[model samples]
Target: MMPNRVIAIGDFDGVHRGHQQILLQLNEWAASLHAEPMVLSFDANTKGQKIITDNRVKDWYFSQYGIEHWQVLHFEQWKEMAAEDFTDHFLKEELQVVGLVCGQDFHFGKDRKGNEFTLISRGITVKKLKSLMVEDLRVSSSMIRTYLEAGELEQAEARLGHPFCLMGEVCRGKGLARQYGQPTVNIPLSSRQLLPPYGVYAAWVEAEGSRYPAAANIGVRPTVESGGEPNLEAHILRDSPDLYGCEIRIELKAYLRKETRFESREQLFAQIQKDGEHSLTRLEMLK
Candidate 1:
């Protein structure tokens, strides 16, 4: 028998709560129909925004959710296909997709006209998961972005199904922490993705499969240095550790304070100590 499939399609930048709901329903539908459960997405990001998550992370997430078939169409090419053509050639001929799944707000095709109705009108079985509502707000990537911007770490994590993370190699830094404070693993945020506001945060630093609670800061350091670009600095609450040149992932857990200038070096050091203690307390609740 030809193996039919249920294709869940979306940008899925953060794979937020609503995406999780749709994927779960896709699994149920696929299982009942004895078909494959798949996710089809594009290698594109929303304009004027840094994504909360990216492709590599999504690949692992899909496997963890018991989904093995993942298809990524490039934005430039896929964007040109007409609504009817995508349903016919890609959905019907290539994927053998008997069932379709997407959020209620989903749109596709050359000019973003393919919606839930487009699939239904084409004799395809479709499931339009109702827009997820939480505290009277919609569950969406944009909502998660707002949570991050507002320094609402728990809310952001709850929506994304995981902590908002910054992953990069630990770059070298000048001796700001060498004399007055603790050494930190400096992770560059650059212009790569969207992030929380410039501030100190409660965090977790992961390296080589180990997780350590940490206090982190993200900003272009104004008080400590000059002409600094945006970056992430995580001071692992335990040992500062030998991390330069190594890669690590930091999870922002909660906001502690906004980035600020200090009157003196001693004053800056003292404030970081207080922020560290407060961050540790907040991170302790996570454990």
Candidate 2:
């Protein structure tokens, strides 16, 4: 039997504080009504803005908040759906949604003609939340992206209510860093994922449920190889199990220095040693 759900719907790009507020309310309502808490989100690619968090991390947030289900609607299939048909056919008959929670500015249906009123008219209960504000400014994914593009991690974190991170599977890379005794894991980046300025950072890596301080670089390894695309590489400060094929999350804590093209691999290794030390110190301070 399908469990009736009370859902919060939005893009929830970063699952920032504003989204968190709605999620909390969703849980409360679901508990009171004896229904499951679910989230209805759209794929990041469907939106105009570059994604702040990928599906993996966004789903992780839903799980953390005790949401039972996270549904990603296929934008192409649903874009032409009418407002009344959406509420009556999809939300009512299909998902068995008992209630809905959305932001005050939420819109839906073809041409964004649907709104909270549209749902209410269909006999669906709706809760709309106001935007979260930080220091007289609205906290939004765009503001967080702007902070990241400028390498303002603290500002981004303030809006996100957590550190901005890159979460993905570790991929095999040229073993050049290991040859220098500083082994690193490469995390392939998606073009749609918004990135900060190309640089080295003091980072925290979560692998196998353990968090380790790390020195991370985000850019093409100009001295070693040539690639137009940017990448993320992190060397854990402490010894750990191999991470290849494992999903890991690297949180940028502090920007250390800009990525530089050293004349020699030896020069790069020397600077990396310094970076590792600095990152270790920074992580300790953050604690």
The numbered model that scores best in TM-score is 2
Given candidate 1, what's the lDDT at residue 7?
86
lDDT of candidate 1 over 1-287, digit per residue (tens):
65889989888888778888888998889999999999997776734377777676677567767889898878788888899899989898888888888888888998898887788887789888898888898888988988887889899888788888877788888778767767778976657577788999999998877888888989887887888888888888786678888778788888888999888878887888888899889988887
lDDT of 1 at 261: 84
User: Model 1 clash pairs?
Assistant: 50-194
> Worst ten-residue run, lDDT, model 1?
44-53
Error of 1 at 198 (Å): 0.2
Deviating ranges (above 4 Å) for candidate 2 = none
Off by over 4 Å in 1: 1-4, 121-123, 175-181, 190-192, 239-247, 263-267
Error of 2 at 10 (Å): 1.2
Estimate TM-scores for all models: 0.85, 0.97
